[model samples]
Target: MALDTAKKSQIIAKFARKSGDTGSTEVQIALLTARISELTEHLKINKKDFSSRLGLLKLVGQRKRLLRYLKATKYDTYAKVVSELGLRDK
Candidate 1:
């Protein structure tokens, strides 16, 4: 259950720094978050899907690394993204 182009573009557009800015760290993290959520829901219904579970873990790790990079290199942007995405407890 991969993300379709429309959904991918929506997430990219929301986080993109500029027009057509698909490769930015914010956009990538948002995309991964979306995918991870989708996979998490799938796992809830299909608990035996080990492959998808592994994929979810990989996505989580990647998003964690990206968030760390953003925090180290651009703390303001990291904070902004985290707030906008509603990630992390208050």
Candidate 2:
């Protein structure tokens, strides 16, 4: 129905950091990624959900921009995230 547990935990851990992570980029990106995945499944059964589709697209764009930022500032972290999220490599 949704992404696997290991991947979900990885994203959740990044988003819910222990300390010194207030308004952190990783947290923001992870949260957006989770939303995107949620909306994806929602749209799967409700294929006629235009509004949800729009929201999903927006989240995907947000995540894409965040990935670009991560790649620019921290390539390794970006790679790890994309791989965990199963996003495209290039």
Candidate 3:
């Protein structure tokens, strides 16, 4: 269950820093978060979906790395993204 193009576009538009910033850290984290949420729901319905669970773990790892990089390089944008996404303990 992948995100549709329209929803993906919405996330990109919300997190994009510039006009064509699809691959920026914030956009990437948002996209990954969306996918992770979708997979989480799927896992809740299909409890035996181990492959989807593994994929969810991978997506979470990727998002974590991206967030780490953003926090190290741009704290303000990272904070904004975290707040917008409601991520982390903060």
Best by lDDT: 1
Q: Rate the local accuracy (lDDT) of all candidates.
A: 0.92, 0.75, 0.91
Each candidate structure's TM-score, on Cα atoms with residue i matched to residue i, is 0.94, 0.73, 0.95
Model 1: per-residue Cα lDDT over 39-74, one tens digit each: 999999999999999989999889999999999999
The best candidate in terms of TM-score: 3
Error of 3 at 54 (Å): 0.6
Worst 10 residues of 3 by lDDT: 81-90
Clashing pairs for predicted structure model 2, backbone only: none
Across 1-90, the per-residue lDDT of candidate 3 in tens digits comes to 889999999999888888889999889999999999899999999999999999999999999999999999999999999999988743
Which residue pairs collide in model 3, if any? none
> Alpha carbon lDDT of residue 69, candidate 1?
94
Better of 1 and 2 by TM-score: 1
Clash count (model 1, backbone only) = 0
